[model samples]
Target: MLGGRAVTLTVSSLADVSALLAALPEGEAAAAAAAAAREPRLTKPAGSLGRLEELSAWLATWQGAHPPRFERPVARVFAGNHGVAALGVSAFPPEVTVQMVANFQHGGAAINQLCRTFGIALDVVALDLDHPTADFTQGPALDEAGFLAAFQAGLDSVPDGADLLVLGEMGIGNTTPAAAIACALFGGEAADWTGRGTGVVGGALARKIEVVAAGVARHRGLPPLEILRALGGRELVALAGATVAARLRRVPVLLDGYVVTAAVAPLEAARPGALDHCQVGHVSAEPGHRRLVGALGKAPLLDFGLRLGEGSGAALAAGLVKAAVACHTGMATFDEAGVSDKG
Candidate 1:
């Protein structure tokens, strides 16, 4: 059903994710050539549009179309409860995750407004809110079965006919897991990645750092995906899965914030270029996000000091994508307008 593929593979194992990685389609060079050819004729000085021009070509290359159409962008926010929240790592309680999901459903969240403003459909997947992951300070957050289930849930969250996917998460205290993931994947001290999630102050932020340090120390030296299973929450893993699913479907993805970036970081670490079709929608106000994006070599599309997750930043980036696509497709050529071309 997805991408008109005859075989639908379920991500029940990390090996399956590996297989998907091996099978990831390369970008369309011809479409990129087409985009490049059109960009010069679009009545603008060469390279004047900056990222908008690059964004247009990126849309063409990833969407595999001559003139890319940004019609069906979808944002999916995965919400889950983290057992690590019990450590006083975040200002908000885990129960807030469930409540926030209801807010998304009721069109009451900032993401809801962002989605309406950007014309992107928003879907929320609350993964096992009643069953929070085991506290990673003591042990693995999710065992193999639980990990696979959340990963599969992520893969399934991606819908068919989606032109692009914007991934965000709504798990309270999840920045702890996200920090842990970044620490494990990037070989950083926990304090470097841990930040004030939910506005935790001095003591709470320090405790969050300690918790991240412990989680990474306990689950270090594993494969990237295993690190993710050990340190990341359900919503994080699901975002990773949806990213894989989007790439498999040849759909581009806009990633949101530190948590979402950390969620998908393992994939790129596991297999280089796994996230080539993906871009960070914005640099989060979270301290670690700027460093994380720098590590991934992705210059974010927007940066307004936004730390609100739930795909709000990504939905806002969708508007940029639409503008990029619109300019690429709708702008008049120098020849068509009878304007002077660069001589």
Candidate 2:
């Protein structure tokens, strides 16, 4: 079983991965209809809960069950170092990735606290802290074998019977690669996708934009999957793989902030409905994140000027999703509550 789903999927190459994405399994129609039918009979005015109602239905649609519940939610944070960090694109050094991963492992990070608060099982996957990918401006970040390895690692990260998956990433210089991937997937200039990741500003931000532009220019017009190998890191590709694994397993996904969004953006571009089972957990403070989400036509569940990676935003949003599912599953129907139907 692949992530608790009975499917035989072999992803040895990007072509295989692309083909898999192009012909992905769809969500359950009956479960979606069942959730919709149950929504209006819950003794409340129609459309009162706004996005919460949609969240419940989304959970049902993706989970393929009548009463959707986020019982076994898992949060994954993929951490990797980047060769492009040598370009001075970030305010912090690349070694920070290792430091942050240790923090997460030791339960001292914000994501750790948030995961505990929201009752999410946390998994921190370090792609390769000692070895960073090749600098994109010089050449591809990862070769075919390397990319596939990282992708498979991501695929293997998803747990069995997880009703919900929350994805995030940690890499000091990852925003540069994420911006480059966004620029390649969507038609945009470097400045349009690049932002002040790691609090770089002034000339530092300008340097980051230049680096993203150079990477895109060197590897532009490649296929969507190639764009990932050309400009993305191991953690980024792993996030994409985990997203695919979750969808294939029929588990709903809550995507974290900017880097995570950019990591999985190529899936949607390669196939339109690739991300139908996923939602933006929260919008990050990175300016490019807002534009990227807009390009994906996604409405984030929350916006609190959050820019911390490592699945923090998604973990916070998990509580809200749990509440949404609770209301959908536990609320009494009009007849059960002795409430009059809308007449």
Candidate 2 lDDT (Cα, 0 to 1): 0.91
Kindly list the per-residue Cα lDDT of model 2 for residues 215-333, writing each as its tens digit: 99999999888899999999999999998888888889999999999999989988998999999999999988999999999999999999988898999999989999989988999
Write one digit per residue (lDDT tens) for candidate 1, span 212-291.
99999999899999999899889998888898888778799999999999999999999999999998899999989998
As a TM-score, model 1 comes out at 0.97
TM-score of each: 0.97, 0.97
**Model 1, runs deviating above 4 Å:** 1-7
Model 2 ranges with Cα > 4 A deviation: 1-6
The CA lDDT at 38 in model 1 is 93
Task: Score each candidate by Cα lDDT.
Answer: 0.89, 0.91
The Cα error of candidate 1 at residue 75, in Å, is 0.7
